[model samples]
Target: MARFQTPLRYPGGKQRLAPFITEILEHNDAVGWGYAEPYAGGAGIAIELLLGGTVDHIYLNDSSRHIYAFWKAILTDTEAFCRRVSRASLTLDSWQKHREVVRHPGDHDILDLGFSTFFLNRCNRSGILTAGVIGGLNQVGRWRIDARFPRNELIKRIETIATKKRRITVTNLDAEAFMRDRVNKLPPSTLTYCDPPYYARAKRLYLNVYTPDDHVRLAKFIQSKLRRAWLVSYDSHAAISELYRKRRQFQYSIQYSAIQAYEGTECFIFSDSLKIPRDSALPYIAQALRQPA
Candidate 1:
């Protein structure tokens, strides 16, 4: 099956981990259930599941107001959003202008905010607004615009994502609160997939960073959901291990960098009720390690 492309690029996205997630969902018969993502950066896994017909409904939430605004804009007025994004130029000056708007949105309309977020994310380095100019441009260097930011392709992607508006529920809320509001109300077959900011690099990479205390709170929240099946993806860290030590854990290596062969060990902590096959998790480590930078 062809993969559904995400409208925005995100750091630590779960594209590579979708296979294992699919396996887990299939094994637990959770594919028919409504899906929820409390920290849906780019909504990679959620979109994958929706496209694959693994899930009928999805509830996507993000803590960042900018991201939430972008999502809302897309789902509400896809044509206008895509039109604005299509007109965005790939230039340093344009990037700077959009960056200004994103940094201090002030009274700007949602379309402006959404387009600014989209342009800055697509043109900026590593899809990070604060990361400055786009990196890894080969001989062209940072100043030169890369062809990767294709206009028509992006519009097409936006249209494709817009088609699923009826099946998705986008919200702007804190992860814990979002969970508390929906965990009990969702069907018994429902599954929650969480890809929160990693404890080790949360502060450095994300605007809405989570602290050690937040991790503790998340651990407790997941533990409290006794009837719902949930899965969390996070980097392997001592603090994280200790917090989720009681849950079933599976480790896999992921290559997050396209310009460099950067790899990190991430753990998938599953609720007690869920089961992940050994074969689904082990082979990916070798494949990720062997991938070219």
Candidate 2:
């Protein structure tokens, strides 16, 4: 049987890269180690690792309050969370209502906030929370509204995740703060996977934009934990490439169909302690340890 899919459709989710991620985790001996995902967007790869028994425990963290609230509800009250999402109506009206509340959810109840996040994410085109409308004005009917929002499938997925016996800790904190507060306390056996927003598209794709300086800060923090951390980002930015010039890097292309089909280069930066086996699924690119002249 196929591994349970992520309940939400995240724009940059690594669902297709699950096999390669599993291969990398296996290569680095992740079976008994704790797995930490600081930027856990849709958490597709993390869920896969947990379900495949690749890790002993998983720590999921996200800076987005709504996203974090949704995950927190899932971990604390899976049935109620699933019920809230399952019963949500997938209509333009419903989408707008939820979007309004998610935009300012300070006064909303926890379950409402969770449902709002879940609705906006799944109902919005391309799973972009900020993108308004269930289907963009020009792209109405492009998404089979009812068919795409499969309540039963989502509930099943949530149930599967909820039943996993392995420990799961969900936190709402800035990535750096989370690392400082929790990561330092964990054993070196912990393997952290950082999938921050792409530097070039952060402002367009995410609410909390990662500026060049933020990228530098993240790089510095990851460098401190390089012995057990792995970072992924688009290979288009020069500053990012320069930041990890001395580290081991792997480049691969990810192809997906949105409004149109597109393929882009993705880079994985890792410490010298991690090795990419020759037999791994990713098409190996030369290690990126030198800056472009």
Candidate 3:
């Protein structure tokens, strides 16, 4: 029932926003056009669009080599990756070993580290590579180490994605480089949706965090360098509002869970090439429904 295309359980993933993005793609006459994500950590939204047949192609890029290798493995080494997933031991000891691999990911091969990244992600709380394991070491909590990882179901999702490998492009590049080198080369109809590292707890939550200056540079570059249709999503941080104060913007909220107040609210800024429905207020996309004209 869920559009569970991605195996990675990313914190603050935009799964609920897939419908809104679909609206953006269709409204721009860009349906079946190229879609891209520069900070493709879990790439939940991109995978949903691709698997749901809303986008003809999806570009997924991440600056972290481990993250990139994880996606690269999914697309290129699908069978082996699925095999590893099917047989991965979900014990805390196994998690510890995979954690070591993630720590010194440089020592592992592309596929090995990729699987390890996936392993640690699924086993860790919130899918954060560096976070502690679920249910704690005692394993006496409400959940356990294997609570999130239904290996059988995970393989199905991975295999389903692999069937469309030719339609998915995976890259390892910094956000700025990806924007300039890869996305800019795509067709003009391509629409890139950027979810940069959120504003708060980013340093602790992500492998890479951007400085205030980096965020400013990104905003400037998105406004100036890129000509294709694009949009950026950031937490409703006051600084972000000021950064994109001149651009077309709106407040967005996820209606799925009332408990996750941490990442429930966001501010979206779009390029002048695209239009946000004037009648639509907060929380733009719901259930892949088309927005108002």
Residue range with the least summed lDDT across 10 consecutive positions in model 1: 136-145
* TM-score, candidate number 1: 0.90
Model 2 alpha-carbon miss at residue 198, Å: 0.3
For candidate 1, lDDT tens digit of each residue in 1-293? 33547778887777766666787788777676798999988888888887778888889999887888788888898998888767766766777788888998666777788788888777766677676666533426544444457788888878887899999898888988888886657787789888888888666567778878888988988887535788888998878888988887756676776334478888778888887554555377545434432
Better of 2 and 3 by TM-score: 3
TM-score of each prediction: 0.90, 0.89, 0.92
What digit string (tens of lDDT, one per residue) describes model 3 on residues 1-293? 44567888877777767777877777777789999999988899899999899999999999998999898998889989998988888898998888899999789888999999999888887788888898888887888999988988899888888999999898888888999998898888799999998786577678889889989999999988977898999877889998888887766565332114453567788898897644332234431124321
The regions of model 1 sitting more than 4 angstroms off are 1-4, 135-143, 225-227, 258-260, 285-293
Cα miss at 4, model 3 (Å)?
A: 2.7
Give the lDDT ranking, best first.
3, 1, 2
The CA lDDT of each predicted structure is 0.77, 0.74, 0.83
Clashes of 1: 0
- How many steric overlaps are in each model, in order? 0, 0, 0
Output the worst ten-in-a-row residue range by lDDT, candidate 3.
280-289
| Candidate number of the best lDDT | 3
lDDT of 1: 0.77
Q: What is the lDDT, from 0 to 100, of the residue 263 in candidate 2?
A: 78
**TM-score, cand. 3 vs. native:** 0.92
